[model samples]
Target chain A: MPKIVDHEERRKIIAKATWNVIAREGLGGASVRSIAKEANLSLGAVRHYFQTQEELLEFAMQLVQEQVTERIMEHIQSHLPPKDQVLNILMELIPPEEKKIEMQVWLEYISYKIRKKELQKESVHEVIVEILHRLQKAGLLKEDILLEEEIVLLHALIDGIALHILMGLVPIERGRIRYLLEKELNRIFVE
Target chain B: MPKIVDHEERRKIIAKATWNVIAREGLGGASVRSIAKEANLSLGAVRHYFQTQEELLEFAMQLVQEQVTERIMEHIQSHLPPKDQVLNILMELIPPEEKKIEMQVWLEYISYKIRKKELQKESVHEVIVEILHRLQKAGLLKEDILLEEEIVLLHALIDGIALHILMGLVPIERGRIRYLLEKELNRIFVE
Candidate 1:
């Protein structure tokens, strides 16, 4: 009898293997052969799941986005105060020590997309805008804060800090990330 | 008669060609063979300036850093007010329309270095830290502001914004970048 495999499960596993390959060698090195080797699956088996390298990469990128969104959604549903909720949600976007690989993979995907002129929409920016809008609706934001500017500024701030952390260019530790974010929240949130 | 090339000038030209290759294709596409083709020189001619592709990439990266630094230094020496000067300096780090190619090349170089575990010192971060310190020393910064935290925050914010701009994720125009940076400066600098 032939062995049976769960189609969706296998795709997830292959997507993750793709992430590993991307994180290790960048998008350039994430060949179908390498991904198959990393996933411990035969080339034919890998091809059965995703027809092309672009298809596999696109699926992997979506998985990364979904994972981040799922985590952020958990933070949003928690019993934390509005300010804390927003801060926590922002923190989810910037990778911690353990989440570094995901961030690296995402960064590589982003650079590749930009060069290819794909111009995909970034969900993180949309999430930030939505969160800020929700806060404003709840009367949590200071009246003086310009919602549009804050959205742009906060989005840029988070991504910039995340990039710095990934590059290890500066000594921005978790403590500093939290402290700086809290300060910004304190400035914009109603006391 | 054999052609006479100014050694340093030829090297700089080759480095610029490398930047063009990196910007058009990711760093992975920046092989010496392609670079030689891009520079309209023979492979041996290209090797005469740099022994290897690694050497060429490092030189190209250094040129990007120098170009950015030179622009920032010009802003620093300007007669603009301290706040305006700081804003201008920050603006130089985030590429405008004309400087997009340079910024793209820098981003790729940074990502490539991180993957290689090279951990090169980022001059932009150092420059930011130094600028903030100068402001504090000049008594331009608010007394209550924590210099260290501000340094980390500002650095992350600028980089995040730059990344977003480079990726075209958000519609952050030059005016918006200026507006946001000025706002941050306004909060930190004493009127």
Candidate 2:
């Protein structure tokens, strides 16, 4: 009998390789062959896990989002205070030291999505809306602000900070920018 | 003298072609040959204007930035009130209908700059700092905010709003995001 490969483990391995390829050479470098080489697997082995490059990239992008969500959830759970929970969740979206490469890879994927129809699906938007709804329900968000506008602004702020942080214009410390974001959030929510 | 080719006019034509190529195929598709084809000019003609792809892209990027700055300056010269001037300048940065394509091309250039070394040195950063300084001088910015942090946040907000506007998450009306930004700015400046 042929050995049964652990499908989930294989997916994780392929996704990690995808992240590495993206980080080292930008989104253009995350080809099947490059990912295979980064994964230390043969092209056939990589294909055995992901049948096509598109499928591989789709899964890789989803995996990055999942990782971000998971980390945020973990941080939220650790913080008992509601304000701390919100702040911690926000921090998770920023580049944690271990996840800097992942964030960089994600940025490349986002840029690639701009011109490509297949990658422009609104799954990320849905996830963002869900988070906003959660915050609103928890009374963490100001009632006066339009949910959609607030959500859009939040996403933009995150993207902006990510870009600046990557460019080294913003320090990694969780002080000034964090205060600014939190303060803005407070302004939106009624006392 | 072969008509001397009107160097400034030729540069504008080349930059416009670069913009078209970016709009059509994105930054990845922006090449000398592609730009020449888009411009309906010979490869030699394009090469005569720009010696390298990097030089062409850098020039195109600078052109976009300058266009934005010029628009802002023009709006400021209308002699509006201080708040109106701040709002108008900020509104100009958002994807105005007349300049949507140019703004999209500019975003692509910024995404490209993420992976490539900047060719124009400190000019872009300096210009942004100057804008921030002007806002501060106008007493529209908080005195307590650190200049570096303010600049970073301002740039991020501009970029973030630009992304949202392009994606259609926010309304195209300059008044909407401008109002939100102005509110935030007021929060910072209002004693």
> Highest DockQ among the candidates is held by which one?
1
Instruction: List per-prediction Cα lDDT, in the order shown.
Output: 0.82, 0.70
Query: What are the per-model DockQ values?
Result: 0.68, 0.45
Q: Give the DockQ-based CAPRI class for model 2.
A: acceptable
Candidate 2 error regions (>4 Å): A1-6, A49-56, A75-79, A117-124, A138-142, B1-4, B76-78, B117-128, B137-142
Expressed as tens digits, the lDDT of each residue in A22-103 for candidate 1 is: 8778777778899999999999988876666567678788888889989998997899878888888898988887888778
lDDT of 2 at B34: 93
Best by TM-score: 1
Clashing pairs in 2: A142-A189
Model 2's lDDT to the true fold?
Answer: 0.70
| Tens digit per residue, CA lDDT, model 2, A1-191 | 99898888888998898877766665545678888888888898888766664576576778888888787778767847665676667767777557677666666665556556334445445556777798788777766778877777777787778766765566547676688778766766657
lDDT of 1 at B70: 89
| Native contacts matched by each model | 0.74, 0.39
TM-score of chain B of 1: 0.92
State the displacement of the C-alpha of residue B23, model 2, in Å, after optimal TM-score superposition. 2.7
